[model samples]
Target: MKLDRKNLLWEGSRMFLPEHRRALLQQRKNATKLAVPKIDEQQLETMTYILQEAIEYEQPVLATYVTTYEVTCFCGFVDKVNQMEKYIQLSNGSQTEKIPFYLLVDVTWP
Candidate 1:
């Protein structure tokens, strides 16, 4: 009796190359990335005004900022502003975050 090897097509070992896996991951990450938005001069002035007001009145605010990959929303109080560095410190009870002036998208009181 002779066993046939031609019928064992599905019995071969499955292999995944590391380079192929990395390429797949890169594609997925690029798909989720967002483009940076343009902020007009009027909008920039508005955001600056809102942030300053929040700081002076000790009011809570909602700030929307964007990065290369995503947009983030932070609900917090304006703790401090660094004029030289052009960044604002936001405190949300537990931790503080330093958001740069250019990344600011919108500011509102809630």
Candidate 2:
């Protein structure tokens, strides 16, 4: 049995009232427009150093990073860094998060 994606989407949306649909769309738009702060070169270098040290020593670090969806404060061991990919991987024992370098707001060493 083939399910038409367009039809399925339409049918699923039919379950939502007009007000619910409007609110859901508004939330999506706002989530996509999160503010990202700008950092000067010195601050960037400091954060980079903290990350490098943590990665080198396998130590946990506290860092504040943001994204289009939300900002997160994480204390975790640095697992990997990919400068070309512009991202870093952090593992906090419970979960590992992939953070974009541009979204990093701050880093404080332990």
Measured by lDDT, the strongest candidate is 1
Cα lDDT tens digits, model 1, 31-76, are 9888668899898888878887897889988889897788998999
**Candidate 2 error regions (>4 Å):** 1-17, 24-32
**Number of the predicted model whose TM-score against the real structure is largest:** 1
For model 1 the local lDDT of residue 58 reads 93
- What would the TM-scores of all predictions be? 0.80, 0.70
Residue pairs clashing in model 2 are none
- List, residue by residue over 6-106, the lDDT tens digit for candidate 2: 77777755676889889999988886876889999999999888887887777899879886677779888888888899988888889998888888899
The global Cα lDDT (0 to 1) of model 2 is 0.85
The ten-residue window of minimal lDDT in model 2 covers 7-16
